[model samples]
Target: MKLTALKTMAATVALGVSMAGAAFAADLRIAYTGYSTDNTFWIGVAKAAAARADEMGVELLDLTASSPDAAAQKDAVDRAINMGVDGIIIGSVDNRAFDASLDSAKRKGIPVVAVDTGIEHDHVSSLVQTDNLAAATIAGGYIVDQLDAGTVLILGGSAGHQTGNARRDGVKNAAEAAGHEVIFQICDWQDACAYETTVNFLQSNPDIKAIFSAWDPGALAAVSAASELGKLEDLVIVGFDGNPANLVSIEAGEQAATIKQDNTRMGAEAVSNLIGLIKGESVPAFTPIDGILITSDNVAEFK
Candidate 1:
């Protein structure tokens, strides 16, 4: 009877431990979304975020919009809500179009973490991205240094897009304040559109000395356009977002310079903060990642 009692107690203890282990084994599910993957910037963000999610053993459901459409991202939020994701990480398409779905997510007790482009919603638990204005100010100042007295064209993203606008303001403010003539055009963040704009603008405004593309892909477009026009060496081309190709272009003498935003770090930090928030830890409302100005001088390091 004593042996039987001991055996029964051991069995009961094992059952309790097994039940506790089962309860702890439920893994977290995260839904990751981005506005566009057309640019290398977002591509880097996705890759880094995925790697971090894997490291954390979290199941990440990735989604993205092909274009800068708010509806797509909002729909993604809804889907994530329906799927009952534990948390959300998103790079918004626009600042204002996500509040409704985000609010819905809040209603379901799911926290949202915004990365890259910010959504102007109070419900976002945290934000991770580079300081756009300062980065672009550096790029714009570089452009001004290259040009003495000729018109400069700025290839910008969506009109009124907060991130793009900050970059635009930075470059324009620095360049104009330095006495360089500046003109602007919107490309909606499309590389092809930037290429066409550069080609067309250069034809009519051949005296333009330099171009500042808000993103690195747009800078590549400017490079292609200038090379085709046989004026590549004559014009100073500066791009934002130090993508791999941009670093290559800087090293290969195809492009002038770029503001290298640590996109991988941004994504990784987003995941980190989201996990912290899920664990009921305190995190900052806004997290800013610094950028590096990449020129031939330091392109080797980044490469």
Candidate 2:
């Protein structure tokens, strides 16, 4: 009887040790959603996140919508929830569209993190984003200073995107407050639309001295449009998102400036925060990353 009891006690101890090891080796599943996979910015974020997940031995599944559409992004989040991921990172297409989905995730005890664009839902455990408004304000101030109160054309993304509206409002408020006339155009974050809109604006408003685009691709398109219209030299084009193409444009004196957001860092930080939450750790609800202004004066530093 004593021998049998000793064997049972030893088996219980061994089983407990095995269970602890399994818990430690459990894979963390993550789901990510964003606008489109084509943009260099989003691509960098995805690559960085994937690399980190691999290093940590975590399972990551990326989901991208046809475009920056709210409904599509929400569907992706819903799918992640149904699949029972440990955590989720959302690049919200529209800030308000993911409230219900996020709420559902929270109900299921899964943590949600927002990257690039923030969501309005209270369930979002954390947000990692750049200071977009501050960057736009800098761009606006630079344009006003260079043009000396001339007409400034503002090219923005889709109508309802929070990032788009924030940037547009920042530039418009700054320029208008400084006694400069602001003309706003919506390109829906499409390069082709930006190109066409820029061409039409240039033809109609010959006196427009500067153009501020919300992203590098749109700015590059505007630069091409200006060149086609023989107004490249006369137009001062500023943009956000310090993409490699925009940096090249800055070096070539084609674009006046761009705002640099550390997309890789943002992605890595989002993953780290979500992992912490999965482990039942505390995380901040919002994490605002800084932005740097890139121009010919300091473009070499970034390059």
Candidate 3:
């Protein structure tokens, strides 16, 4: 959509008015596919998307994948396409794995809006996600400012995932630039793996002064591991995806900082973008939402 139209959509969605609630010519059916139901962040995204769909009087099909795997998520998209939904919204498991399904959607004239994870397909109308690189840089800068130069461990997301890679790169760039030795580990977005990795890494590298987790759960896992190893007091911990539990950790002074994404806004905005594309209106290729860096000094506002 044009800049003016995009602004109008944002205002309407943000204010619950602008024009989102207006009657549509026909009932629109949009399929929403989240990464997984058990994930806290995706749960919030799904709830917001459902709320927005309700506000717009559209039918939202919850075709969320049961597992956090490329095959399962791709299957969900295929199901949505076979059902002939007007448009699709996805928090993709792997952006590169949906080529065939997205091509089919394009052939069928079904527009797609991606939330969180971006799919680089012409059929995908827009991507609404956190500005991860910028947010993680801020988080990294916070870590750099808080501690003396030393080893900084990064608990990263799954390999090859765009969102996770960006977060990893952001922090890595900042830490390396500041002359801190960086240790990287891929948790594959798994809590158990993160916990184990943190414990093992800290055991061998006692001089490590800080840890940056790409996701909140990973950060919490780090907190747990550090507490078990008696390293919590000596380390500065930072995380992304301001999950409630991580915020609680911050409130308790366990985690030093986090980059909190507006997941709710992402969901609602994805819905708005999908509707626009369904109506044959042009939508922007990307919409970057800023993340708030939550620290102990201001964790209360988020908590």
Candidate with the greatest TM-score versus the true structure: 3
Using all chains and alpha carbons, the TM-scores for the candidates as numbered come to: 0.89, 0.89, 0.91
Q: Return whichever of 1 and 3 wins on lDDT.
A: 3
lDDT of each: 0.87, 0.86, 0.90
User: Residue 63 of candidate 3: its Cα lDDT?
Assistant: 84
Better of 1 and 3 by TM-score: 3
Q: Give candidate 2 misplaced runs (Cα > 4 Å).
A: 1-25, 66-69
lDDT (Cα, tens digit) per residue for candidate 1, span 127-231: 898999888888888888878778889999887888999899999999889887788999988899999999999999977999999888899999999999999
Lowest lDDT 10-residue stretch of candidate 3: 17-26
Model 1 regions lying over 4 Å from their true place: 1-26, 66-69
Candidate 2 per-residue C-alpha lDDT over 1-303 given as tens digits, one digit per residue, 9 for 90 to 100: 999999999999999998774565366788988766888899888888888777767788999875667688888999999999999998776777877887799899999998988777778879889878887888887887787657899898877777888789888998899988899988888899889989998999887899999988999999999999999999889988889999999999999999998999888888888888888889877778888889899999998
Candidates 1 and 2 compared by lDDT, better number: 1
Residue range 126-231, candidate 3, lDDT tens digits: 9999999999999989999987868999998888888999999999999999999999998888889989999999999987999999999999999999999988
lDDT of 1: 0.87
Runs of candidate 3 exceeding 4 Å displacement: 1-26
Model 3 error, position 101 (Å): 0.6
Give the top-scoring candidate (lDDT): 3
Clashing pairs in 3: 1-282, 1-283
